[model samples]
Target: MSAKITLIAMQVCGVLFISNSAFGQATPQDASVNQGTSASQDAELEVLTVEGRALSLYQGNGAVFATRTNSDIDKIPQTVQIITQELIEDQAAYEISDLFRSMSGVSYLNYGIVKMRGFEQESQVFYDGIKGDPFRTFTIPQLFNIEQVQTLKGPSGAAYGAGEAGGAINYVTKKPTFEQENTAELRLGNKGFFSGSIESSGPVNEDSSQRYRVGVYSSTEDSYRNNVEEDNLILDLGYAWDFSNDSTLTVQYTHFDQLGERLRGVPIDENGNFLTDISWNSNEPDDEQDFQSDIFQVNLEHSFNDWLSSNSTVRYYDTEEVIKFHQARALVDNDDDGVYDEITRRYQDQTRIYQGIDLASYLVADLGEHTVVAGADYHFASEDEVFYYANGVNNGVSNLSLTNPSYDSDISAYNATLNRDRLTELDQIGVYIQDQWQATAKLNVLAGARLDYFSEDYIDNEDNADNTSYNDLGYSVRLGATYDLNAQIKPYTSFSTGLTPQTASDQEDSLDGELFDPEEAQQFEVGVRSYLLDNILNLNAAIYHIDRKNTISADEDGNTSAIGKVRSQGFEVDALMDITPRWVASINYTYTDVEADDISEDNTVYRILANNPYHQVGVWTRYEFPAISSSIAFGAEYVGERTDRTTSYDAPFTIQPYTIYDLSWQTAVQDWKLQLNIKNLFDKEFALAGFNEVSGAIVGERRRIYLQASYDF
Candidate 1:
């Protein structure tokens, strides 16, 4: 059934493109009507002004401001997806993961940074044009006070350093506008859930020269299935001081603390077949565990002069997790009387810190019509990972030896076991130059490259002799060109490069010389972005061919093995349409063509486990009623089924495409404001996991509702 749907989807998409192409030739006859329809649709956000400025907050509400506008989005050469704040509010999505229901070609690999993508790790994430956090952290975002989110496809390495080809995701935080902003919400639903938040930001002075913003959120809940609950809290504080001059200083800090259940993959039998009614018990009965992850960061940017500028940041992360499952599932009998054996227990804790300085200067040199930039950056990060495992009758694999199925108010009974500590440090220094020059009024040439030197070291506390260090040098390059086929449409092409390390494991004998060469991943991209219907609507489409090789895999002998490579090529189309005074819509689609260059084992390798799907799509739209001062938005997402070619056992695992319908209403009653949001309107059961890996399993969210009211002085 899934296969049938996949084929039909592919055919329809092809037909739509061909049919649209044909319509292109009949433009003269439909030109008048097209202009009218386009205008009517565009009226939705064009006339709308935020306190009287021709700005679009909802159109790209969730996108990075610098890259969300029609002028910039249409001028760029890549595909992008925008999830506006309004849309977020409408969905009442409390976390970034909730967005999977309305996104395409992207899925959480393991509820973390291991998301499936056409790019490698080390990809960058941004919040208001500044780095957010390390990609490996897989930090989930809080939505009580976000403005916009932008997902840019292809390598953004040109603007962001130490990036992977997976493109980038930039989140724009809610800013303290010149005018007052106010909102409040409370959510209560099934599974003993309760959540609440309040936020306000505006001018501290009558002149609107100084502003302040604060947001706080907290949630407590027990989930569907056994031993699952969520306890999370978030805080955001910000201030902006705009001096009389053209200088501004904005200070913001975000802190989040969460204690939630660890993710669990679906269970499989001895034959490698998934269990029929796998325990709805989200709890790992054998593992009776809990997790806590906390993060905090500060950002500062001072525009001293137009010719020179500096940006700096400080960040810290701490995580603690405990696992109590038995490594061996089979039972054993020490005596002749057959008896069962229990699983052991394990726990892990980690702390990481990062401090960095990035300073860039835009040179005012007479180099024709060229925008030249030169800069240097230095950063250092250190991490300590601690692990422990225990064995005792009190800590067995089964419920008998572990906590009972029922809830436990206190968690003081467990004891610590074998303990191990590992420390790792990374230091990097880089310099780069970039130039964006217009060859002609109709064409632009862009070029940029960076040379980065990185050092890494690992130390084991007990075994001093096992400690090791390594270093490597890698260069990232980007080249592209854009042609203006008039101001309404432009076509562009680009090529970018990135580095993937040869190995992720600790180097033993040769940590310095032999294990330090950085492998390369390359990408070729071509796209056309356009502004049609009077520059109010946006249409972007692109095609890309990406390849990765020289990846280090493990051999049967557990030695370094540079085996096969992976490849994916696809075409995509994304659009944002402002059709009416109160209606807007967006869509993203990708059809990837993938193949393996080689594999350790032909049959077992390059299998369905590759997870490079053939097709993916997303669509979201919203409509607001200005008369009633209320608005509504709905979104849809689809992901094709996957096959496990290796086992041929659930060879065809069908994860039916699920749709989540959401609606939000916002209006003002004098000083009072009200909002209502609904998520997973259909209450569908599904998974957003990316592949056949053990981590590719999740119990999707169910129907949820939220409501709130607020008043300001």
Candidate 2:
């Protein structure tokens, strides 16, 4: 650890201890005065009430990224889902995948890939409305410092340029608050897992114009599989200043460090069955993976007058990673004994750096019965990447038998043969504009458009030769309308377009040095939002159809072309209700149908898309007992069967469906709280993902338990 980080940790610990001791001895008069003053201040601020917080799990009133303004959810003509801090705490979530239980039509695949609406969302992740590279390190961002997560379905290309057709996910970080709050927590779980964290936030000045917040977290754990372990540390800090002109400036910084051993899946047998009998990891004990990152951002908001306001944001990100592991490459049957004989291993190394900036300004005006909003945005990004690979035989390691494996082989030969090296550089820029109008008392309209330009450069570092350079320009647009039938119900419809630029690697694979055109997609959607029983019950439903063109494919003659097309259609529904004053429940379901046309042969189509489930359902409920200040929650998730096709054998296979259950209990006493969570209640064995060629499969985690205790000052 660095000296600066060590000093900060010591200071935070000392402050937490001193604050707890001082707050424990308050007199009755002081306590009463403090309560009265806090209530008065809360009335002047837009604080979230207990009921409002509870209702956020099912529906949120407003979101900034959904419309680039503080517009009500019912007024937006798209499907959006918000996952709040309360839900994160109740589920004891540590990673992004754990929070997907509250959403429908989304799937978490291997290597942290999230799929939505039958499309992969590998490059469509955002933080505070700014884009971030999700595949940079192959690890999802930790959820310890996040306030909420929002998902906007369908194409948002008109607002954010250069992305996939699967939509986008934005993570909102915790900000400094005027009210004083501090907390300390400790967690213990199975497999020698232990974690601790401290959080503090409050005003730094008497006038409450300046505020500060800080959080520190550290954890260590051993995995269920052999030779796998992990350690991690994270630090976050924030400051906000409210100027005399009624404007605000906020700055934030975060650092993360993680080290662990990579886990490789077991190879499949000849009969296309997962090797469940394997009790040890395939990689050697010396294999390791390390990651480190630093992030900084600044945000400014100013109001020129009552009818016009402007906001801008800037961010910088730096990340470093190192990986060394033995990967399974191929399975061969050397002997005719009906069993796999040899397993080959490969080694790889990669490094990448990413930096980006986004600037946007907005104007709001009112003329007659119409409310008009206009905006313009500009974005720029640069990335550099390098990769190297080595085979097992050249590295001094020998292939092993399937039934009997040995780890005594040396890796010195492998380290000496790492000669291949490649480099790639990418740059992008975009501009956009949007407007929203209230046509009448019960009608609303929205329209937007964007233009983008991007370029890519590639080179072979070892050979000192340039490969290729590619560039392209693209445009997108969106239009929507909504009608309010009553105070509790609204119906809407929209049409949107999306575009994705091809990379240098994609172009290099084409025949005769011909570059492929960018992929394009269009979608049509209809939805309804309703609330009943005095805003205690919330319901939402949506149906959508998408058509994608110019997808790349390979022909039997070994030539690549952009003559592919795909169609996807789906329906989703969600409901959340406060059954009484003490009980809460939420339910979500989705049905998807996806098909692709034949690119290798004429007049042929696939029945299903790989790794995409046709049906999904999730349910969660919580009940509280005020007498004991305790609450218990129950949840269940179901994933339907999916299909995968093998190209070499021209055959199809199926992955069976499965369901998992979870339970949580929480209790509070005085200034302390305790919680217990159990996952995979039935200890069922299942596969999270697999390949149709019978190469390997990823096995889901087994039953585990976690217990945590926290104190508030």
Candidate 3:
């Protein structure tokens, strides 16, 4: 080991020893497994040196449940990416956003907006195939109880229900195991970061027919940006009972809480240069954003015979949120000299309450060389929202100097007006059937169809004249075929269609006082997968095209129409290789070209679509040293340049291209594992993307260092 690494390892050992003294306790498994003896040490080293490389974590060779089928990932014709739990641990990830950095065809924008395959996605994140949000806006899932994350590229409305046209993300949660196990972890880092978590799972009875698992995670952190701090708490509880050899039932509950300040981007010049320090704040310290949610789910599995089986799930979710902040309105050019001198800010207070219930069931039948899957699902939701603003226009806010920012504005005693008070209800039912056929020795065919019925009611609590009700029937279809050319290569092609229901808020945004039809999407994809060199390397590549129509659009006069259309085409390549017994690497690249058509001639929505990048790349590599029981990893990503604009006449600015690098080290001793991570190692000063005409660019985080220690027995 290098001298620098040696010193860091020594420091980590000291920290672990101190922590063990304060938190460690004797356990049944720990007492039986001794690591101090020479024989045990030799055995550990032999195991690591002989069989340490993990191809499953990097190659994604397992089955994917997001398809609601029994086919292996390699045999499926869709583009699916599986991020394993092992990778999460290696990276010491804290939240879902942390993992998105290495993902392909995915981008993160401000205000909880995530783009997948060049389209904006909301409420598309799922937990074990069940919907997680009614309209996700400000919060993201934590990583405490997640086992793996599966990202299905393109629209999945045929298997799943109503959603965005982009894609869907499914989080597989950890379940109760019969084997006894316990784990605890503590993390400390710069910028006032601290976190603690513990989990335990084992048999609940001597008969081993009952099992239980419980986990708790809490974290608090301060950001490099000014007036930004967040605290989070989560509890995961689960129980499983085996009724007989052919049947089992499981129940789970999760409670989540988060509190933080909602911030806007820092103002920038026309060239995308920061007008002030990246740490500058446009909100007050007293501003706060709070969110809480509760989820309960039950699942049952039964097997009538070797050829037939069934799985069912039911879930209920409720969430509440409150947000109060100073929102940027616009930039003012007092001199009209093509330079901005002042910025306007407004006060906003909003509250939301949402509840939903979902039920889904599917049966699988195996007949000779064919497997058939049939499923049905139902969903219902209700939401109430209220908004309070200082006024209805920019006059309610004051102006601040572009170079000098102040947060002394107080709205405690100011009289605010109710801008909106509304309630919305949604009901949906869908049924789908899919069949996978082994047509011949080398060809496999898959086909599916779905029919969905949706109903929606929007009520204006403050204005009875604005109430509206609507319902519709939608259909989706999928067809695919895969050909096995040889033992190491397979080629596939697929076609699919999808539809999304327009939210009540979106419908209300129309200036013509008329609702539009639901949006529709169609996609065509072709890909190939290969395994070479005795399964030491894996490569996959794909090209796809998608078209979506009936999008909402507004003209310069504020008149709206459902005549907008979008065209998205992309190419992606991913590879994983084992260079040596102790070395592994993964590389991925994405090229996306998205355009808009049939929009209002005088609108800027087409220009705003340029915010999505055209090219992206990610790489990760790791190497292990058996003698020291340590491993090191390096990661990097590049995002292509994009355009930032808010209106048709606004002068657009260019967001420069940038790259960020990360490093991590992990070592194990006895029953303890320690990890140290350096994010943004070079402290690159850059912006993610622009929010609006005047809100400036969202600055990226500076360099950060954190260490995590975990104990498992």
Candidate 4:
């Protein structure tokens, strides 16, 4: 059934392309109806022109992913997706998960994890080209001050060292512009959600050489699950200065504070079915989670001449978190009723702190037909965590009944026990050089290589154990070429390699206690991109195969080894078009297949990779009625079935597929604009991800509605 629907959608897109192409070539005509009019009192027709700006949703002018420099997307020779501010506002996206619904081959998982190209992408988020924490707990970053989001799919090790196989996501924040602009907004929604925000930017000096900008956001909301609520506040400020010698410097700072209730996974029955009657939150009403972060960055660019330019950047980041909750331990048949009767509970307290610094410098040189870039970077990061756990029959926390659950239990009898106190430190340095050669008018070549040195140290204070340290040096490379068939079409292919160093703890329980090697991945990709109907429609398709080695796998005896391998191959297609002056549409489809190789005879790796769908689709369209100053949009998304194991060595279980729909409307009157958004129009219920039987599964969100009003001056 899915195959048939995909075929029909492809045919319809083809028809629309042809019809729109023909319509674009038609000529306009004007008729002279009133030829006889008195000279003294001539009837006049008012000629009012209603000019419209060209749409930016389908346009990809410049990007900085493939290389550190801003270049045209078609010349990058990779799969890059850009989510513009216009699209974010049109979709009314508030968080990173909300933005993922419009993208292809990307899905949200538990605890800040996202699956991209059949691989888990964790801790690969960057802010203004600097890497941030990968394990952000409880809440994702809000979109109140972000300008754009860029995703580069597949291995990008040649440019950015020590990354995952799934690629990287960069968040570009709003910068200071020398223009007078201010906006104020208020939003209200279901589930007792409300928010207010303001943004202001302008010049600070008479010559406009100095500029400043500020943004503030505050919100309070309740979740669909019982005993779940959130309160958050965010602030962003920026300053920029342009010197008389053509040099520029910019500084930025951001602070975030949040307090919310944590929601654990839902329980499952003996047959691997979700317990529909149970609430998503498994803890008491008094449970709490807190997060705070502060980030500072500075960037400077100087030009000595037309042929020589240099750029430098430095960043400092700090974060702290505290969590207190009740965790589910096990499911047992205490009553002997043939079904799960009770759930054991455990009390936990955890505190974590993280600090990091990053510095990089780049030099760009031009020589005839070749343009080269040389850069180097250094990173230092440290983490400290303290954890306490309490588990006993007489503890304050009470066991929960599978059928009748209550959250009013007190924990006065619980005694906190110190279990873990650990400190981890890491340092890395990398250097690389890239060359872009315009060999001919229609052909281009790109090549680059990077060498990186990494070291890590771990200390366990509670046990007074010996300090463990690991160090390694890794190298990555990339080579690609692109050929233009015509002014409207380009075909390109690339090969790249990636590397990630292993930590000391990864060898703690190994059979031989030997330090493991770093994980490595290699990829080969080919794709074609086209611009039709005078650059109004953009179409792209690509196919790629990737092989990852040195994956950590464990045996039945609880001993670990890095002797596993997996291969992923997939194909993707994306289309963005302006059907008419008042209509726009986008469609994307992805097909992924992942398989494990029998590298070690003693290891079982069949069901280690889960929660990745084989087929995914997303489609959206919007129309504008200029006469009424209003616009409307509608979209739908589909996810295919997935398979997972009940335990490490157990047989696989299949999870069913599901689809969701969304709608939005917006209108403007003078300086005020009103918008409404409806998500999960059908209120569908499904599982987002799952692990072992005892670990249960994460449930998807239900229906939600939001209304917003804004004024600009």
**lDDT per residue, candidate 3, 1-713, as tens digits?**
13323434443454456445432233443111122221232245422211125465554455546467657776687888888877888777777777876678887676556778888877677878877553347776777889888888887877886787778888888898777767777788999777777777778887869999888777777898767888877889999999999999999998888888877778776677877778877677778889899989999999999999999999899998888987777778889998777777778899989999999899999887888889999988888899988742344456666667666675765568899899999999999998889898778888888999999999999998788787888988888888888757989899988899876667777766677788898889999988778657777898999898988877767777788899889998887878886788888898988888877644346343756889988888899898998999998888888766455466566676779999999998987899999988899998777765567777877898999988775
By TM-score, the better pick of 1 and 4 is: 4
Question: The CA-based lDDT of model 2 is what?
Answer: 0.73
| Residue range with the least summed lDDT across 10 consecutive positions in model 4 | 30-39
lDDT-based ranking: 3, 4, 2, 1
lDDT by residue (1-713, candidate 2, tens digit) is: 24434544564576576674633321112110111111232246543333422474445567878778777777788888888777888888887878776878786565566668877777778888887542354676788888888988888888787787878888998898777777778788998777778887778888879988899888777777656777778899999999866689999998888777656555554333565444445667677778788888888888777777777777777777767777677776788776666677776665555555666556655454444556655555555555556766766556755566676656666654445456566666777777777887678898888888888777666665447789999998989988888757889999998898887777877887777999898889999987777667778899999887787777777678887887888999888888877788888998888877745542123222666788989888888887998999998889888654333435455566779999999998987789999988897766565553434555666777899988777
The parts of candidate 3 lying over 4 Å away from their true place are: 1-54, 333-341, 391-398, 504-515, 555-559, 601-608, 645-651
User: Which residue pairs clash within candidate 2?
Assistant: 395-413, 395-414
- The Cα local distance difference test for each model comes to 0.55, 0.73, 0.78, 0.76
- Highest lDDT: give the candidate number: 3
| Residue range 1-713, candidate 1, lDDT tens digits | 23333433453344345433321121111111221111223244334212100015334422322222213343344556777664565566677777754444465444544233544333366655555343234345566556776776665554555565566777767766666664455556666666656666778887878888877776776755455666666677888877755556666666666655555544332223333233344244333334444445454544456544445445445454444332222222335463322222233223333333333222222255676666665555666656664444354312222222333212245454546677777776777777767687677776878788778787888788768787777788778888877656889887877664432233563323367356566778888877777655767788888766665544444455445566767887776777775677777776766665544443334342444456777777767676776666677766665332333333434433445555566776755567776666787665554333232244566666666554433
Worst lDDT run of 10 residues, candidate 3, spans: 30-39
Ranked by TM-score, top first:
3, 2, 4, 1
After aligning candidate 2 to the native by TM-score, how far in Å is the CA of 270 from where it should be? 8.7
Model 4 residue 482 lDDT score: 84
